[model samples]
Target: MMAPATTSRPTSATAPSTFTSSCTRRTDGVTMCAWRDSGTRIVPTSSTSTRCRNPATPTRRTSRSVNSATRRSSRRGSPPRSIPCVRCRIRNRRKSPPGRSARTRSRCRRVLSARRCACGIDRIRSWLTRTRCCFMRRCWRSCSLVLIAFVLAACPTKTEGGGGDGSFEVQDPLTRRLMDPDATTDERIDRVLAEAKPGNTAALPALLRVMRHRSQAAFLVVSDGKARFGYRTVELRETQKDTRSMERVAAIVALEAINSPVALPDLVLALDDVNEVVQNHAARALVRLGNRAGIPTLIANLDNRILQRETANRLLEEISGKQGFIADAGWAERQKGLAAWQEWWAGIQASDERLPIEGRAYQIGADAEADRRIGFFVDVVGQYQFLFHEQARKALIRIGEPALPFLREGVERARKDDNATTRAGIAQILETIDHPNGRELLRDLLTDASGSVRARAAEAFGNLAGKGAIAALQGVLGDRDPGVPIAALDGLGRIGGADALAVIRRYVPGEDSALQEAHILATFAASRGREQRDRTLAMLLGVSIATRNAAHAVLVRITGDDAGYDSLATESARKEAMERYRGLLGG
Candidate 1:
């Protein structure tokens, strides 16, 4: 009956025995197919079971069933050698849609673009390999190093190329010219210097080069050091119109080269030389030297009918110590003191819009009740007072007689019941005026109530030092106030002459620990030398005067000496630079 299910199934399973075992009957009367391989069984029971075998004849199937059962028993004893595939209902229905994943697409696009870019780069690399300049890299590196070095050098430092020290050194172009053997330049320079009144335009460059010894001083006079030097010597000697002119230019080179007071007399004579060129150069040289040697001569030259007032003014501006080096030197050098005093007085009078005494009285009354009222008004007056004092002192020696009367009146009035304000102003004004009353007033004000007034009085007394000022100034030396004593010390320092050393030594004491040491250092040669000079210069640089006072000092000190004190004028400029740098750094 089941006659044979074999009736429907193949006897030898022509369908290629996918099932490895024969059919078998279960206890429930259900038939099953099974297969066996390597002692493992594949049995199909439910429709959900996995099929890895084929079914054949019952005999073979029966054998497979027995073997499959045995394998199953063994499989139960041992673990599976390979994992079975898992079937997930969710995976079957889920579609990936039309596009590949974003990551895969991006990767593919990148690979394509990279391949193209690489191909292009390969072409460029090949071209460069064949045709690029061989020395390009070397040249680039060398130029870069040179540029870096230039940038570093241009940045200022404390080394040899730093600060103003390089200002005095030879430049590259000048160096080249000096090294040249050609006589054309020498001849050309000779003819230029030989001109009767050499226009500064053509002569300045050649002169500067020659002066620095960067170019040959061929247009200069024949001298002991340069007679056999070279074509420069010949050209210079040949260019001289006369011995006088030669001597004048020669003196300039010597002054510039030597920087000595001994050259003063010769320079003074040249200031009055009949030749205009000689006079101009000599005056210029004296101004350049920046010592008292040429100051009297320069002042005396002011009387020249032919010299323009503008020229005189220019010369005055040039020679006056706008920064008060002469002040640092003290007014004892009468010529320097007078020059500075006159310059200071002139500046004060020119800028003063108010009646000097009346204005201070009104200003003091106005500020009398406010918190900082006194200081505010004092500062306002002090600005003009200090500025003018500085300028007047530098140029007054040149002004001489013109400044006396004003100086006398202020000094005379300041001595009696002078309020601190009035006394200070009067003393300051008198400081520039060399008249008798001016000296007397300043001397008397030395005993005033206020420290500032006394300071002003002491400074004025120093400025007024004549035979008359000695006793009064020395008396001021014994004042009770420390600043008063310091001021008196400064005055004595500037007024040095016969009573100078005794007074200087009286309070000056040992050069080592005195307050006057700064003032004393540059006024005259102390027992100490360079050390004194350096300390004095440091004091000048470090002393923190008010802004206008500092500006006035810088302007006056380098006046005339720097062609116009341009280098020295930069004291204020440096302050401005600091401010701007601070802003940039967000400080």
Candidate 2:
């Protein structure tokens, strides 16, 4: 206002008017907004106003027709005029010239089309920008949030105290609830079993739940001995799904826990459990009872075909020492039981041809398993020959009595085929049969070319204890072979019959080396106790007192002084002893 200010506002008649405000921005850049309804604005009308010129006209922004039309519409007491510039007026007044052709109009259209293309390009760019912005927003909202969080969580962060992944974070409400001491019992039980190590007091709630449920949980806890010793304790009650079997297991376990005599009845009842494990455990528990009262039950179960024979056998062995079964009427009961077993075994043997081997074997006992168990029994007969002499004799007596016909046929076939072992086995079985025909079969064996058969026959005949057997012994005593005569001497002495005394006395004297040798051996077999010692002394006196070199040599032979003859003489004693014992011992 101090001087005439040059105006930035245009004063041209065709210039369009525009109003604008000036704003001053603050240094700290706090923005303020004002609300306005309606207000009157002052237009500058001073006479000393300065005018300015603008090279670009209003027609540059709006067409002349548009400006003119606006002017006409507002002329009826409307608004102030908006003038068109001279270039737009000049363009509006121009007409096509006479030579103007379609090509020229096309050229004009091309310029207009170029302008439209530029506008379209701007709009397309704006739309693409908006679309990209929308896509970025959707990606953040729909997918990236979880993905970013997951990726960030994968890397351990110091802000989270180095916890790696939030996926493994303990955020489950139930899990948190379990940490509280006042949590519900169900939750507490689950937590203790799942999280707490064994022997923790936290196990108490689970133990309580087990008690109330009265189920396998109780059984398991009690079995572990976690519940203290009491009626309410877990171990005291039977809780297995198989109640009958588990009852036995529980009772046995409880008995062991309590270690009382009161467990005896329970253990015995457990023996009747159908479950093999329970039955076996019961058997073991009875052993634990250590009372004589359990012996009868154990002995009774010894023949129980339903029970596992091995377990039963083990139980019998374990408990037999504690229970006075050998002194009790139990032995008699055992004998009856053995007889029953034998009878049952006999039935199995009789049924062997009809039944499966396994079924037959299992039915009798594992020991009597097959036609081949017949072989095992045969082997056992030979193995425990002395210890189970009576049992072997009885069992063989029964087996031989039945198997004789088959063995006889086998023997005949063996003889026809020149099979010595089969024939010998048959003869051996016949000897064990020990019937009237046994002696006759053995006599036939004496004629056999096999020396073993003949020796076996001689021993069997010697053990027969009869006058006919004695006559056979006398004949063998006169034989030249040392084996035959020595065997005869043993047989006659074993028979011990008065009828053979003269023949025995006939061979007692004579210093002929061979005769004296035979006499010394005969005397050793015939005499017993003091008589044996006397006979040995007499032989030594005869040898020592004699002046003959042959007698001295014979004495050296018998006394093991000459190493050359020592082996022979020693072998002779061994043979004589073995054959003689086998005869006296039977089979």
Candidate 3:
């Protein structure tokens, strides 16, 4: 074996020098080697060892390229070396042959540019992660603050001017004390009336707020010992405990006493109050303020009960300088009066003229001097001049209850002469008084010899809904004058009851189409059950086409069923359809 081992030596071209070398794998999966030269310089080795012998010559990769490769290898979890082997740089670069054109060299550079990296990718990723985390934290903090602010805003909080007990506190001490529950009603009302002087705007808000409080209890009393109920107005004293009404009335009075135009809007709103007393006070306050805006309200009140009508007439005369036809006129005459006033209003509006208050202040006492003036006006009501008669009627109405006695005396005197106009005027005045005795007096006037007086009395009874008046109206249903019978039928309908319905039914069979129509309307108004529907169905067989058509209309209105019947159809077709309607009603 020693003789067979012959000595072998490396050829000069293929032998490597006695230098140290290291090998490493790059991120791109290429093996690279670096050599340590004799001068202690690190030189990158190419694929072939022959290229590494000339260590003084520059290799494909510089120190900058090696640093970039090291950074790329660190990001990709590959082994990192101080320098990349020359073989990798040479393989990645595009080498144009020598003497190539400039365009070829430029294309070669662009083609290899993608393989080279300039900055550290891993360092950029680390900076982005830190920046994104910081931005998200700031955004989360801002959103949390906004959510907290929204939650706090949704909850209720005490305002600066609120009381500890959570009620809105008024700035005025006297108003606060007046509104206190512990205070006596009389004492509070007295203080409110005393302090709420004219032009005291400071007390207005508190006073207006308390005006809506209901202080009165309503009750029905039987005056005639029958089924009829009459409304009685009673004042709630301090002993009653709840004085809201007393306070509201006092507030309204104070607003009137103040006589300020600023209170006009509040007073106007008070006109529609549920309490009659409040409405009365508000209306009078508007009159005192010298504003004609209350004219329409006063006109509407002409149809109300006695106290309100009296006040309405007084206010109307004071505001318009013209007599209200509603005061002394009959129903037909009142229509004329309304028309005249409406025309006058239209003219004033077209002209755009300011309505000047006539400085007419009404005196408010029932002294002897006031009584004498009332008596003089009562006498002048029978005077020759129409204007003087109207003015006198207005004056007597304004005197209110004090003129009732004189008005009764006038009624008796006019009855002796059988004066229709004078008796009507006096009877209407007494009706407007709406006293129990005044109603009785009107009942007696129903038997008067004058047809005109009887007709007017019937209308008054209708408006009053007099239970006793039903019998008297039934008797007048046969009156010679058509107006008397028409008025009687109207009264029966207005005073609706079982007896009134019976009375209306008696006239339904009559030949007078007008009276028959009135009967059907009154029956519908008084009765509202199977009995009325049955009676109305029987009326469809009436001889008069007009009466049958009217009854058909009432049936449809009550039941909301037309039953295929047409009013303008021929008699045979209408009869056939009516038969069908009867079958539908299970007749």
Which of the numbered candidates is closest to the native, going by highest TM-score? 3
Per lDDT, the best of the predicted structures is 3
- Relative to the true structure, candidate 3 reaches a TM of 0.31
lDDT of each: 0.41, 0.40, 0.57
TM-score of each: 0.26, 0.28, 0.31
lDDT of model 1 at position 454? 84
TM-score of 1: 0.26
Candidate order by decreasing TM-score:
3, 2, 1
**Candidates sorted by lDDT, best first:** 3, 1, 2
- Please state the error at residue 237 of candidate 1 in Å: 60
Worst window of 10 by summed lDDT in candidate 1: 83-92
* Local accuracy of candidate 3 as per-residue lDDT tens digits, 1-587: 01111112221346423333454444433334555533346544455321122222233434777656644643433323433234433433335345645334333433233234345767444433533234445665798899999998997753212112333334555556666666688877887788567667666656654563443212101112231121111121122333376677788888777665444434655665565556666766766754444556666766666566666676656556766655665777766766676777778758955455432333324234334334444555565656555544654544345456766767776777656677776666665555776777787778888888888888778767755678878878887776677777767766777888888877643577577566665677566424555556656766767667767765675557788887677767777877776676566
Q: How displaced is residue 575 in candidate 1, in Å?
A: 21
Per-residue lDDT over 1-587 for candidate 2, one digit per residue giving the tens place of the 0 to 100 score:
01111112332356533322221222222111111111324332222211111122343444667666655533321222333334223332342233534334223322332334444667545534533234335554676588888999898543210112111222334333433335555554454345333233333332222222222211111111332221111122333344223323443444444443322323443444445555565555544433222333444555545344444445554533222223223556756645554454456446743321111101122222123323323332333224332332333344334444434444455567665655555555565556666666666676666665565666677667564777766665554445566556656555553455446767653445655555554444444211233333334334333322332233343333432222224445534533433333232
Per-residue C-alpha lDDT of model 1 across residues 470-577, encoded as one tens digit per residue = 677667666656666666665655565546656565554334334454345424322222224333333333445432342334223322221222223466664553
Clashes of 2: 1
**Which RMSD values do the candidates have, in order?**
27.7, 36.6, 28.1
Off by over 4 Å in 3: 1-369, 376-401, 416-418, 506-510, 528-587
